[model samples]
Target: MNKLTPPTRLTGWGRATASGASVLPVSRGNIADAVVGAPERGALVRGLGRSYGDAAQNAGGLILRLAGLAGDAVLDTVQHTVTVGAGVSIDDLLRVTVPQGYFVPVTPGTRFVTIGGAIASDIHGKNHHGEGSFGNHVRRISLLLADGTTLEISPSQHTELFWATIGGMGLTGAIVDATISMLPIETSRCIVDTTRAHDLEHILTLMEEGDDRYRYSVAWIDLMAKGRHLGRSVLTRGDHATVEQLTGSATSSPRHYDPRVVASVPPVVPVSLINNLSVRAFNEFWFRKAPLYRTDEIHSLAGFFHPLDMVGSWNRIYGPRGFVQYQFLVPFGQEDALRHIVERFAASGAASFLAVLKRFGAGNAAPLSFPAPGWTLALDIPASFSGLGEILHELDHTVLDAGGRHYLAKDSHTTPQAISRGYPRLAEWQDVRNRSDPTGVWRSDLGRRLGLIA
Candidate 1:
């Protein structure tokens, strides 16, 4: 077993909530040993720390960070799948697979997340309206349970446990590795279509009318817009470009894929630069810069999907108090609830610059998965804003009443009662989790706060 590092203070990508835990670097070879010796506080596996919340945190417990999990990425061209160690990140996976004319079946907004984290969180992307989330494409998983026993699970094997682990928030067990079905692509670029919507209803109607034609779709909303321009947005939708769509030099190496960080935010920002005035100005500039309607515009994959990744430590812009990413999903037939929340944000001058709106398809059987047939909106707000807690808590009631739920991966607020109201299958999932972790060996701060464990 590797030596355990002293208790280290760790925070999520949002840098809002933090906890201290002894971090131990464990590999496939020594994980069982480590699990057998976990302390009374129990243990939890942490990935690259992108969860924006406390899902991967374990206060005063053992935090296992997988090492040597990416032993090798074995690609099976005929099967259109790749079996890789769970510790491998989507960023590294893309660097290998994209060059081979393939892409991940689903990816979140950022590429820095580990495959283990992706599966645990069941991340969804802009393409979710068609392809579903990451768990949908996963063929199999190697799970290390609380009893120090390793099990190979899939849709048809240990079926219930597999689904429970999909969005179980890493409380089910430690994911060792996985085999994922990859998407075949002709090029590493995308052919995009852009449109500017005048208001919330306009954008929602446009997406409802035409989203089926594209494989990926997302809208960036201007929350600061009010009155006639409430929810004004820049909608971008597209799919991987074919080789024929490339022009000039790009056509020569259409499959070549390389992404690099262009800049970084300094570490010592004292106050959040994101405020009402600055966000309003930025939103205006963003809305104006996008073409009124542009089609067939070629774009690199990195530019279209993960533009924020280009700026390293971008969260630092939110300053020392940090920020919270509140994402909620209201099911179909609940458009009124969605509108009410949007209006609330607009009226409150929330100063949210990164508001995103997407339409989700039907969700799978993952008991804890966040998405359903719904309209989901995600936004970031400075944590130190006055009366922020009251505003979010009030909104939680509205969301729960409308049969909506919050995303645990991005949640730093929201209460246990809210979670119970949101996920009807919570008891079912907890039963399965408890049976596997009879002694409550696998645990996390998220689980305890949300009463996920018995």
Candidate 2:
């Protein structure tokens, strides 16, 4: 087996925490050997590091970067599925599949994430209210267990292990490959409708009443707005545009799916560009830019879904201290709790330009999946903000009390108690995980912090 690289510091996308781990590249041929030789601290697979927290960080241990697993993707159009290496990224996948008239079943805010990370986090997107999470569409998974054994698991075979590995945060094993059902699309554009909501209640009413009509929906709220303007948002809902909807040049090449980075943040940003004053101004402009009510506006898939991806290394705008992305889900009846949290953030002058709210549909069988049938809100706040930890901790109580839970993939502030309260099926998942990893061979900073591992 090739030697592991010297210990190197790694951090999740949020960049709030960093740890040192020896990293190695492992293909299917050498993965078992890599796991067998893992240090006493154990080993965990690392993907694109898109997770906002420590889930992919294995401090003082080994981090395996999956490589050369079955090579290029094998698209089976007949079955409407793609069997691909877990290392394949959504960005790369789209470039190939979109032109071929297919799209991933589910995609989060960004397309830079890997297939393995999507399954591990069981990532959801705006259309979650209609399509469920990524795991729901997965037909099968090739997993490398803790003891250097490989197993092909599906919903019907090794059922318990299959669900456990989904959203198990990589503790159950290293995912090598997967077969996922794909969505067929006629073009790379979305026929979007935009509506500006004046307050929290207005936005909630709009989404609750009309979300079911669209395949994808999301609302961007101005968290800095106060009182009458609290939770003021721009709601955008849409579905893939059919070829008939395209005109002129678009019609000539409907599936042309090349997305590019339009701009980039400099490497050295000494301090955060975000603050109450700046965010307030930006919020006002953002709100005014959207029409009070607009319909059938054609938007590129990247523009509508992963706008942040257009600005390369945009996280650097938060400066050297980085930022924290706090995302939580509240069950349907917990609208009161959702309102209170939004009110709190607005009142506190939390400078978050990226606050968004979406309604999730029924969750899958994954014990640790973040989405459920409820409202979910995600926002990014500068970590250097004063009393930020205390505020988030206080909100955790409200969330848990309302039968809501924080998303582990985006978590950096939630505690072990909060996690326990959030995921009732956690212990059941642990039971399956422990059985598969009897020697406790797989580990990560998140697993340790959240008490996911004994």
Model 2 steric clash pairs: none
User: Please, what is the whole-model Cα lDDT of each candidate in the order they appear?
Assistant: 0.92, 0.92
Q: Per-residue lDDT for 294-366 in model 2, tens only?
A: 9999999999999989999998999989999999999998999999999888888778888999999999999
Going through the candidates in the order shown, the clash numbers are 0, 0
| CA RMSD per model (angstroms) | 1.2, 1.3
The stretch of ten residues in a row with the least summed lDDT in candidate 2 is 66-75
Q: What tens-digit string does per-residue lDDT give for candidate 1 at 28-78?
A: 899999998898889999999999888889998899999633438898999
User: Which segments of model 2 are wrong by more than 4 Å?
Assistant: 1-4, 68-71
lDDT of 2 at 34: 91
Q: Give the Å error, residue 18, model 2.
A: 0.9
What is the alpha-carbon lDDT of model 2 when measured against the actual structure?
0.92
